[model samples]
Target chain A: MVQIPNTPAPTKSPAPRPVPTSADVARLAGVSRATVSYVLNNTSAVRISEPTRRRVHEAAKELGYVPHAAARTLRAGHSRMVLMPTLPVPAGPLYSQFVHDFQGALSRLDYTVVQYGATGLRGDDAARAWAELRPVAVLVPSPGIGPEGVAVLKRSGARAVVTLSPVAVEGARALLLDHADVGQSAAAHLYARGRRRIGVVVPEEPGMEVFSAPRLAGAREAVHGTDATVTELSLAYTEESAAALAARWRGLGLDAVFAYNDEYAMLLMRALQDEGLRIPEDVAVIGADDLMLGRLLRPRLSTVRIALPSGRDLASLVDRAVRNPAAAPESQERFVATVVHRDSS
Target chain B: MVQIPNTPAPTKSPAPRPVPTSADVARLAGVSRATVSYVLNNTSAVRISEPTRRRVHEAAKELGYVPHAAARTLRAGHSRMVLMPTLPVPAGPLYSQFVHDFQGALSRLDYTVVQYGATGLRGDDAARAWAELRPVAVLVPSPGIGPEGVAVLKRSGARAVVTLSPVAVEGARALLLDHADVGQSAAAHLYARGRRRIGVVVPEEPGMEVFSAPRLAGAREAVHGTDATVTELSLAYTEESAAALAARWRGLGLDAVFAYNDEYAMLLMRALQDEGLRIPEDVAVIGADDLMLGRLLRPRLSTVRIALPSGRDLASLVDRAVRNPAAAPESQERFVATVVHRDSS
Candidate 1:
């Protein structure tokens, strides 16, 4: 029963340790834990000296210390979650890429972005489900939330309720992204290019109606005084549907088309080409949401480009809404979509 | 001082109520809050009658009482999150749809699926970030994680660590999805259809090497015993790359191609068509991942279909692993990808 005595018998290199904690930073800066927290979180109520704050910052950076999000949420009752409800629609590569960018920005702001599934939920039922998360902020996309739902969410202590839709929701701060602008820009571009007969593609998928209906209305508005006519063409993402549409392309007497988005436009365009219609020569085509695939197309797809606010800007808005709470709830830009002319048109 | 004599005189309808809690369920079920919690959560260590459990369920259903996730996490340390780290690869519609289904299934099992942004994180650092949430389980896809990362996660109380790849990581239960099988299947289909010269598309995008390299290797394996030649074609999603490939198409002299996936296939298809090459006549094309966009092409795309285990099955497996932590790890099916035939090849 001999104990291993603490003697300087051998010199061995120490194994790699973990990331630095707040305590480590505080110890290094010769400050208290409260001061470290105050400096790190920018707790304005705390009157820490300038030199002390600078020392804390330098220590934190040197030690590579970052605050743990969950622990912070637990201690403060102010959650770091920015929960984006999963939409019913199958997100294309473009939307996924945009979401990825948003996640990166939100993470930079020390918010943990959580994507929650809300496929068939609506009204207060959906609100109740989201409230279970106790998120600091919730960013909802179209098939925009109703007033009762917003009230429920607000009651549940969501500091920032934001909707990304065509119009602003009453109780939520919003970024307006009207599909009508997309249709108007595309249709107007085609009309300016002197294409009189226009077909507006409406995807037959169930969830698309929210986005497509307004687009159709906008397309109709674009051709109001002109000899141009806008006809709603229902199409699905199946081979049979595309073939049927391509089969009747010549008889429809359409010289140009605004195909809801790049995906649909690419589908319709490929079919038209197979049906022996030379793109932009026999029938001009335009799409919305300028995707990378659009460029690889034969005639090169002309698309309505949505100029979304940068991720940093959106993150800042969320932060402002949470921090201030009483700020005005509106977008600086009412519309973000524009026409990006390519070889197709 | 009268409050409308207990409100019996008025015939007005009542206002909507707030989100239901366990108290409402307890009152309805004629049980204590502890009994209701025990019955609803199936707190196995506590004894409760079947009739009591039924009553609790009925009461909860009637009131639409959902357990608050954060409160449950705080009380029991049984986290609801099945955290999937964001991979470097661009998730197309297929993966997004799959994830959406997974989320729905996991939610039905009272697990919240959270996607964490780990764009630049790796090893223990990434594990530490994920561990901060204290998720019950984590489903990791390829760029196989290290032992240190697994140990960090396990030490932080992750009950289950699952990897979706051909190669299993130590200390993690693995679901083997050998993407190479997809390539082999696609190439074999082309060879069986009498196409000798084959071009295998390898995406030039940074993160794509994880998928594309193995696929190319498998394609070569499919033609090992034959005179058939497999050519590796480097393609990017850009228009210029497609154009450049189209310009050099005449010199490659390939009769067939197995593109990495549907997105890349579609991009190349349009370019080949623009270059005046006839589909299946001058060149045959096939791609892995049966994306919906593929079907709309004139010569409907042939694809390698990777039949992933259903979300419910995956959820059950996760639950099983958590309940029986000492159980051996194994996949029911080793090869997930199957070849789905269509007109393009």
Candidate 2:
């Protein structure tokens, strides 16, 4: 048998190395500090010799000297940062795609996009946390920020405060994405298909209530005075949960179901199929968010296709808001929900 | 019909408002500026009356004065910010969950988490941009940072530079998450199950080469010195692409396939079924990343489940590195890939 050697003890801490500064770059380039600043910052107003500019840039690169963003902000009294608060739960594919697009668009406009994780804080506390960074703009999700939060951010020098909420928020630009319209469109389509006793699925995931509650209310509103009845179905995004729900399908006597979204719909549909139920013939089903995977199902899933303004369009709106902080805030209806007909319903 | 009025012309910019400062709080609290700073900043070395602290807090709240993060960093010579560079591509569910978990863990350690979107930048340019913010730590993805980039960041006062890469970086702590293991596990499992002719999928998505290329190579490595053969299949993440590939499957004469991931596997499986080819009988299919949707299919998917180091463990590693900047950089293997046998294989 081979014997292992003992591990060595940790060494003492090394002495600190001095950080490179602009002065070092200026000395290396044989130029004045003012000249180095003008060349590095690209101050077009003050013209400098091309050779001098090149020398300054080369020296800075060799020294690995970078301008401090905090110092620049202090001098300019503003930052080109657009702050976005990350949500507590993981975002689905659709929202993730939108965020990527938005970031790309903002980058094109010379804005640095920063996502701050403001978990365990809400409303005014969250806003105060964001204000500490002194971002030029703040984009928040619904129920995370209110009028008081908006006031706090603006007081800390934020030019624009925007919210993606169901209703318009006072003192902020509102990008209205009401979940009710999605449920209304899905339920109305089912009712038109002559399916009665419809059930609406509510996801049991935490942080989903902000969206699921509005959808449930909208479904109830669709069948308020009609002979068709709407029933609430609680489901989780898991195979076991879906199988348990499908096992009692016959007792519920429902003719159709509107799963929360395409993911939940796929889960429930598979479970129902395992329980020996026929699609459309025995129980019709529909879902929201027309994901690509929905079409892979044998009976292609019918869904509510939700449309929001393009990321480029929203970026342009934010730029306008930042430029004109004194102008009255605008609230636009941005949600367009429509039903896509398929074999599932 | 109601008459519509023309839109109003744009208004001129309004007068700028005066920003409140700590002086205003001091005046409101009827205390000196030094006392206000000690009370608000919670200076442990100084002793103050409880009633005085309450008065300072009430005054600050009324004035809506927030200490600037930039100013505090200038004074402290360091910050509690852990900067992460956001990837260009939209992250999948597994990665998104890991990010949320990591952020939560970092927040619990009293560190502020900020994700910077460094679009249109690479290598040293990206490092220079991040260094401008003076972050205490930076966590970057694979192929984004190199030895020179790490040196630049260290010179700019970054205490911890970590990278999630397949191989260990020269001067940074590396969290090794090799994609090759995922493909190797899947291919080895298929070979053990009597699969002879195998095809490995490579996604055509632009930013996916960093992951797909290694996986394809690993699959080839698995079939070396055996009677089995490996073929490469190029595919896009779309139904049309899958259908087109499936249309030509008969001429290829492949008996088994290792799809890039479960999402692509589902798409290909559906297309093959539409082409009248039965799963496991005509061709055995296996995928990497055991997603939940894989089990919902008619024939449960066989996959390579990848286990990564927990977020809490990574957070602790970062904290230790930050506290001991002079210590030697460490690299640890953080990926464990295993195959889950199911009906498809």
Candidate 3:
């Protein structure tokens, strides 16, 4: 054995420094940063030899190089993230359908959808908290939130602010889904079906002010151009309350009812039936949101189908607005609603 | 003008170096580091003078001593965040109720709820992604995920992994909610009402396996224990499908039908009535989830009401488990289901 003079050299450790960066891979492969980027992103614009690609791949494998998400975000400036504030209002199948559509649409547009839990947080506080995440857009369910909150969110780097409300906000693009139209349409359908006195079910929940107010307004609006009178009846979402409403239907002189949504409509209809009232012949009933249960009824519940704007369209608009913050604010898009005639009405 | 620093002995600035630190407050208010911390944290054990407290607060305000969240988190060693993966199932009113109750329960326990959008991710990929956030617990809706996924989540530092599934994983706690019970109850209700031939509405959506399968199974289980025979019908949630089903209701010879949930139930009922079929007389219809619409239907929809475990209990258990990770894993918690008999059935 030849004895060699001891020269201090670094030992090759089994465990290497875990985090390998793109720069390290580039250095090992002897490639330009742009070439590596192009290859990594699968950009067809750059032309690289197969051998070169192989070398780059081998170097990346040897070093365990992975791109940093933070670095990518920093470069992009804005995240591909959409912040949806959780509505405190109870979400039903109708709202759920809308949400599902919205999410699918946004995902197709390559926008990451995030639903922030905002049960307790009020307007500005919720906005401030949401702003911390720096989302590109925020879709509010247009119930409790207003323009001031939208302004705060816009200031926090949100480019597109859209809300579903009866009235459009100043800064935000509104998907103005008129709840009044739902009521008006239902009333009109019932009226056409020879329903004279229409009873409107009012939910007795604290946070239902936004939903109830617009519906009442719409009911009044529909009756404004007709001889049919709309009577607002407060009812808790309970069997007893529904039973009470049904029992008093004869005394109220109401021939038909325009319940807020299918849920309320179903409840009132049941109570009326239990009270020995023959639907359509004695008391015609119309509902909003055109739920499936309405169709399964004995004298199927007639309903106003409030058509929601296509989720794809809304999501596309948000994407475009987010990309170009300088774009002029767009007006609220109104969707057309039609009444679906059934046995009840 | 009271400048006595002609020799440049010392310099004084009104604003304390922009951002305030504990040392700056201690020096300004003439208090120890420990005293300042006690006052700032509002520790009742400490008996600091009111005057000193005021001075310290003034000093902090002058110096702009905003508490750093990251630094605070670092000191705490664990996050107060609870991660709930978004349910892939199309949401409804029943889900909304659960979410509202769950959030309320969690908030009372001082846990911040965060809903993660889990559309594109599943299994280990989802676990690794969620784990990167370092959440203390993860509550996932069952069916879309499996046991391997749960294990992955557990390995990722999630202490309490609770899923709403009958299938339990090795390490995680399962909160089994028997959806089959909902189906069984709804079917039994119809049977007791003297309905013989029962039709179960199965949604023909591609991705609703988690929901539809369980409901179908429940309906099957109920039929198994009864004289009534269960007939499975594939129904797409559309006007066309409902109409078609209504046209064929007489041919099927079904006296009663469980339309999965209230939405489908309402849809089917309307369609049946459209074809001149009377509910409860021609076919008694029952739905699950006891949605508000069920009550609002003319002959209110008879439904199965599923009672989820009280969120307060779950939150408390989660908090305790998180605090004591070494403690034995909690036993499975079960939810109860019952029938809400109304006019439709």
Candidate 4:
């Protein structure tokens, strides 16, 4: 067995060979192309002979013909893509976690999460661009898209048109995250702590205005008719800007503040400290989006805890829409926002 | 324009209309489907009359038909999805910004970024699952994939196989990010500061081990036959864990530590401060990924700044690979990692 005939050992290139398809499987199985498709897809309606089914499976296995998701999607007149229009803001941990979980759930349900850059797209034009991809579903931001855009998406065969807001779109399912609740909860928490002169720091960044505007409005609404007063403060995310605001802290005379989110709260906290304002005595602060870093603060920052729907629930909803196609629009359910009072407030 | 008294105003539903195809445009233009496609796509190889091109454009515009990306991909026997197997770790700001720019670049180039959830998948099975989507390109993790998996993807129509590491994989392009450089840089920075005893933090998390192991190896290699000593420390992302490590910090006799990344560094920094440790006096610390929050810390954090390729460059490379499949593998160019000194270290 040691020394045989003089022959060269065979080698295989790393370059991949052409893959087998359903057509190849059908030819090998001695069946029609329709039969191959039916067997592979397990078409529940059409009955196939047990022997024919076995042959199709056997041939598919021998040729390594996995029914391609894209090809199958084409046959079904849809794309497997679930387009998530990227939000303008750089996603922090909370949003990142939500997306991560959602991705996991969708993957388990067999859908690809395609994050589309919609920063430059607006309204129907954005919808048109999105439609070009022929995505089966789209998770669009409510602020950037409206009824016309939704119509465009629907026309392009998007089965599930879900909006990222608490108010339901005319013909799409709403994920229903009410930012007002975040502001309201933070303001209410500060009020309960006996801080009446409240200040809401509205971020001056371009993309953040969508969130900051509603938050400020909600805070103002929460304080109306009450002893508390809600004042809006404009702030940018630079140290110089924070320092400038801190320098004029005494002139504003706000006792309590609802910073937009934890990041802003942290920024303002350092600034206020640099201005020599004592917490609770001079100013009390509460931020939304309860982040882990907030816990590491000296006085431990108080925050508004956001409760989002689990990935499994959202994924099931998308899958249902994809499967059922059309159904009566369900009423929007508000996500919960509760106050977590740490020493900062 | 005023509305007519007798005529009812039109309403648009969110549901989209069926998209028009090349055949529809051809019928209206009184031209062949091939002529319509060539004219619409601006196929330079085929010459057409100016009147014919104008007719095709007018017909397409009148019908409100834009050439669908999916239909074209189907014609080309490929999917526009560039599958990115998601990492197990929660995305920090560094990863988020990188992905954001990458997505923007890809979208501008008319490619979709499909972030596939591979937490539940491993090895060849994961590749098979990814292949089902028939992504034109794949950015796979080094540890999770192998040569067979790369082969599977190529066979399934994935035009480019790229790894996250700089080290080349069989038949795949690697996006060179060497963890050794990150470790060496951090350790070298600490050594230059005259800190002989250094502690390297290895996060006690499931997904983080892949990074932590290499970092530890790199640190060990950097200190080999040197006067400096590198000690390994296990830390979880919990307040209690950080406090426990801080409690033993005094006994460990370590003057400097290179925490895995910014998140861990921030967490440990707070714990150390709480335990009455003075920055740079009792112990100095450094982390990687120059996140925005690190700049906000009281004694501002020092970090390892990773300079990744511009998204435009990376996207064009991917597009080039998709366009030309049989090209030779390009030489690996290491991503630059440099130390950024601040108050902490």
List candidate 4 segments past 4 Å from native.
A1-20, A25-66, A79-81, A192-197, A225-229, B1-68, B79-81, B141-143, B251-253
Q: List lDDT for all candidates, in order.
A: 0.80, 0.87, 0.72, 0.82
iRMS of each prediction in angstroms? Answer: 7.4, 1.2, 7.9, 3.8
Angstrom error of the Cα, residue A163, model 2: value is 0.6
Residue A316 displacement (Å), model 2: 1.4
Predicted complexes: DockQ each: 0.20, 0.63, 0.16, 0.30
In model 2, the Cα lDDT at residue A290 comes to 94
List model 1 lDDT by residue over B1-345, tens digit each: 757656565334333355577898999999999998888777899988888899999998777676666667657655767888876665877677767777777777777777776446676677767876768898887655877677666655577888877677788888887888889999999999999999999999888888888999999999998999999999988768977997899899999999898878888888898889988898899987787777766688888887876666777788777766556666544557788889888
Each model's fraction of native contacts? 0.40, 0.66, 0.29, 0.49
Residue by residue across A1-345, what tens digits does model 3's lDDT show? Answer: 865679665544333123455787789999988777777756788799989898888886565454433344435544666878767766767677777777778877767777777457787666656654557798877555667767666654578888777777778877887777777777777777776788888899777878787778778787786787989889887889989877877888988777777767767777777889988788887777777666666677788888787767777878877766666667665766788888887
RMSD of each: 11.6, 4.5, 12.5, 8.9
Top candidate, metric lDDT: 2
Every model's TM-score on chain B:
0.78, 0.94, 0.79, 0.82
- Alpha-carbon lDDT of model 4: 0.82
Docking class of 3: incorrect
Top candidate on DockQ is: 2
DockQ, computed on Cα atoms, for candidate 1: 0.20
Identify the CAPRI category of the predicted complex in candidate 2.
medium
Each model's number of backbone clashes?
0, 0, 30, 4
Per lDDT, what order, best first?
2, 4, 1, 3
The most accurate candidate by TM-score is 2
Against the hidden reference, what TM-scores do the models get? Answer: 0.75, 0.95, 0.73, 0.84
lDDT of residue A329 for candidate 3: 69
